[model samples]
Target: MTIISVYYTAKMTDADHKELLEARLADIRRVGDTVNLLTVIEEGFESNAVRSKNERNFSKEVNPYVRKSAVVGATGMMKVTVASLKMFSKREIQEFDNETSATAWLRDELEVKA
Candidate 1:
């Protein structure tokens, strides 16, 4: 299994989200291993449209292939939205205020599966 960690430094557009996710998924397919995703959203989404689109895309298309995910650095509405989306994800999904806690949660999820 591999943990794919992505650190976001700037606001993410819809295309940026797709590109990053697809790149990671391609690597997972090539490696043929379970992947735990850790996304650190430092700057948030570019717009409400971008956030909604990405959320829909992730919940419908990308989440099934993921084993677990921990989203870090989300606060305010972002945190609330992410937390609410948990029902749409088949894999374990959680939000955190910091990378250390998010990474720890992902590791714990992996260990539990192991």
Candidate 2:
């Protein structure tokens, strides 16, 4: 499983934000396989308390830090939050309220039935 470990913090800049996203996308490209994007976030919501963010919005408000994933073309994450959901197509959208639910759903949905 392609697993990505991440921690969501409100402290970040647009450049740093873009850089991280690009890096993650590059990593995904390197794998070219279905992997789990495991993220250990703030357990709350993406706050807009970071500097140079509000005065200069990053084109979106996905908790600048967490938003990095979406910017990296991770549609799976893009459709996670209410604001970012519009960044993707609804063809095969899957959302789970919690990690446990998501894990089971992935196993059931992505894995073929015998």
Candidate 3:
């Protein structure tokens, strides 16, 4: 599985999104595309426009490689952003208030045999 922790306090540029997507793609490739992801985002988006654009770009590129995703530490607009992303994605996307809960849910959802 691929796990990512994102913490930022400024607007993300297209290049930033591209670089992140490339990294995620590389991770997926390394895992042979059978991947679940846990993304803990802290203060990543400064505004709705930035969140929407970034998520849109991510959904286009990374969603195909993800089988499921758990988004932790999301609140307010970020919670809304995750919910909106769930609408168009074929893969499952869930939000949580903490990493523990998110990881537990992901384990259950993916039926991890560990």
Best candidate (score: TM-score) = 1
Clashing pairs in 2: none
Q: Candidate 2: lDDT of 68?
A: 21
lDDT of 1 by residue, 1-114 (tens): 578876655665667777876676676566566788887877644336665666566556556567888888776666766776776667888777678877877787434331
| Candidate 3 residue-wise lDDT, 1-114, digit = tens | 555444433466656755776676676667765567787766654446754676677667777677878887776777777787788788888776787877777666434332
User: By lDDT, is 1 or 2 better?
Assistant: 1
lDDT of residue 87 for candidate 3: 86
Q: What is candidate 2's local distance difference test score? A: 0.39
TM-score, model 1 to reference: 0.73
RMSD of each: 3.7, 8.7, 4.3
Local error of candidate 2 at 63, Å? 21
List TM-scores for all candidates, in order.
Answer: 0.73, 0.42, 0.69
lDDT of 2 by residue, 39-105 (tens): 3333332434352243123223222222122112222223344234335422122443455544544
- Angstrom error of the Cα, residue 91, model 3: value is 1.7
**How do these models rank on TM-score, best leading?**
1, 3, 2
Better of 1 and 2 by TM-score: 1
Task: Kindly give the stretch of ten consecutive residues in candidate 2 with the minimal lDDT sum.
Answer: 64-73
